[model samples]
Target: MTLSDTNHAATLALRALAWTLGEPARAERFLALTGLSPDVLRASAGDPSTLAAAIGFLESHEPDLVACADAIGATPQDLAEARRRLDA
Candidate 1:
């Protein structure tokens, strides 16, 4: 991907991550599901794998994916595309 595309993907991933952590229950669930400790999450916030994992978590549940997309001013497709780019 181009640098701009990569940047956009990164931004979307970060936003998705924020949305995931915005609620205590969701955050706890995310941590449990991903097996990522808070320290690891914080330390690797900018890592592509971490970012992709965040989006992946959202993608795993359609309701959450759609809800998060709405909350973050993005479409679910946008988030999926972002995840693809991050994976690439």
Candidate 2:
């Protein structure tokens, strides 16, 4: 997945969400930071706003952003750009 792909933003956000949820503590932190309950998160997983929030969550923390980007085969900038696209 190249950053330029039209669907890249949503895809990357989903992957980031999965990575965020891979660990219980991190997932709890994400939910806390985003004010999203697990049920709401599941229900809105695909919503553009929710996706953007996921990207925003990563963006707010450099370590997680870099780690998630590396884990997902994307650059930190790619994640940032994806957030921009999603926000658009």
Candidate 3:
């Protein structure tokens, strides 16, 4: 992805993470699916790797990905691409 695209993805992923955490149940589900705890999430939420993992987690489940993308005003593909860039 281009640098601009990657930057957009990162921003979208952070928004997606916020959307996920907006609801208690959704945050719990994310934590469970990602094998992350509240403590870890708090500690790493700002880190690129953790942000990428959150996007990757959403991407792994299409329904969640679509929902999250919609909620964050981003395309699912952008979130996925952001994960790839962050992972790299």
Best by TM-score: 1
Which has the greatest lDDT? 1
Q: Assess the local accuracy of residue 73 in candidate 3 as a C-alpha lDDT between 0 and 100.
A: 78
Give the backbone clash total of model 3: 0
Per-residue alpha-carbon lDDT of model 2 for 49-70, expressed as tens digits?
9999998999898999999999
TM-score of 3: 0.84
Q: Give the Å error, residue 84, model 2.
A: 0.5
RMSD of each: 0.5, 2.7, 1.8
Which has the higher lDDT value, candidate number 1 or candidate number 3?
Answer: 1
Which residues of candidate 3, in runs, are more than 4 Å off? 1-6
lDDT of 1: 0.96
Local accuracy by lDDT, each model: 0.96, 0.90, 0.84
The residue ranges of model 1 lying beyond 4 angstroms of the native Cα positions read none
Error of 3 at 21 (Å): 1.3
Q: List the residue pairs that clash in candidate 3.
A: none
